[model samples]
Target: MTEPEVSDSLKTFGVVLKALRDETGLTQEEFAHRVGYSPGYVAKIEQGKRFPPRDLAERAEPVLGPLAAKLLRAAARSLTRKVGLASWFHEWAAIEEEAVSLYAYECRVIPGLLQPEPYIRAIFERRLPPLSEEQFESQVAARLARQSLLEERPNSSFTFMIEQALLERRLGGDATTDALIDNLLTQGARRNVEVQIMPLRQEDHFGAGGPMYLAETPSNQWIGYFEGHDSSLLQTDRKAVSSMLRRYDKMRAQALSPRDSASLLEQMRGAQ
Candidate 1:
């Protein structure tokens, strides 16, 4: 474990962003609204834990006034990303931000978007090679930033299918499981999000093919993403995307309905 991952350029960008934000006297939430992003995402940009998206300058100019644009441009000059994810993951995450519809199925661990900080910390704490203190913190911030997407895009449809075993495993013990269930319930209650569980007794699970993610872009074009080891594939081949979509469709049918899934989680809250 080492120190914080913020680079010189990133630190300067954050300093300028925070300065402009303070000068305008807008709270993080207020600035986020003006910039069309979540407050948490805006915070990360100011803290340099997440990269400033390219269009941020455009979004800030009007809200912070003409002088603000000059500061943002200066900050933008030396900007580099801070999410700490692989390049491929960065691409997939960018797509998720703008996706009109997203489907995620997982058998290994809780989907990142639905995990609480405790659960997220538990997952990263066990990495094989071990993350530096800074890497660990940055990874957590990136994931939590991504989770904000569920709330940030109210019109976008998001469905997550999780294997029952993952819920029952309690990776970080009872306290973490409690927090996890609470977070899941809270998120699932959102109108645009759906949570389903692949029951343990189901002998036929389409998602047995392994975890996958599918998203429909703003243009209505669909794509699939698959990860293996340290690498990932962003599949745009029509046939491959179609196949993933079909499996998702079948898994959606086999997994417990959202209502039942919530009930199941509630029932598991203290069963351990």
Candidate 2:
């Protein structure tokens, strides 16, 4: 595991060890002996002073018992939940963090995962109910933090299918749309991010269903997340994920190629 993943793993191990020891009512020495590790080693792991080896986790699983391992996984998930601003948001963030590839379709605007700060702020400012300045900034910070995934080593592949109308939405007026479109063109050149514009003429496109994101992890598991007026759903069911995947595939086929997409953006900029 890389440093970040290892750090996350250590925290997971520490929480698990502490929970298991408490449940078994066993001293460190007792637990270590049963798991075939030295007492000091177990203590170090429980304190998060060191990361337990994967073998250790496998061995400890049986020693700690099924219930303990299950609880440990749940505890790790609980830690992640606290970081998500909303219940549904956490699930999406966690999955996105672990994803190795991303596919998305957006009808009305840019997807938040790829949006620049100015565009994001403009969207927030136009919220129907409006937000306090502090709340708006806090949400902006959260959104920016989520963008860090784009900077990860061995960057995840991103394919975003957005409607052509999104380029004309003047949330912050012409300059904002121009800048945002320019940013999209810049990102489209990156080897990692693949951006496409669905022509306004494609009224029968698969994306007509709605906006959705399909994320695939290194382990090959797929998840779907779709945002709504006041809520979001992190879909884990294979059938649902497959359905979204099909939609994304069709949308990709219908959207203009990356080069053409960039050219289209340039035309919009000149027209503006």
Model 1 spans > 4 angstroms off: 1-79, 270-272
- Residue 132: error of model 2 in Å? 1.8
Model 2 whole-model lDDT (C-alpha atoms): 0.72
Candidate with maximal TM-score? 1
For the record, the alpha-carbon RMSD of candidate 2 to the native fold, in angstroms, is: 8.6
**Candidate 1 CA-lDDT value:** 0.84
Model 2, 9-80: lDDT tens digits are 556768677877888788888887887555655665676544343345456677788777676665554343
What is the C-alpha lDDT profile of model 1 across 1-272, one tens digit per residue? 12236667777888889988899899999999887776767876788765666567887899998888887887787666655565567668767776789999999888888999899899999997999997888888767767778877898999999999997788998899899999989999999999998999998877768999999875689989988888898999999899999999999999999999999988888575
In model 2, state the lDDT of residue 270.
87
- Return the TM-score for candidate 2, rounded to 2 decimals: 0.71
Cα misplacement distance, residue 100 of candidate 2 (Å)? 1.1
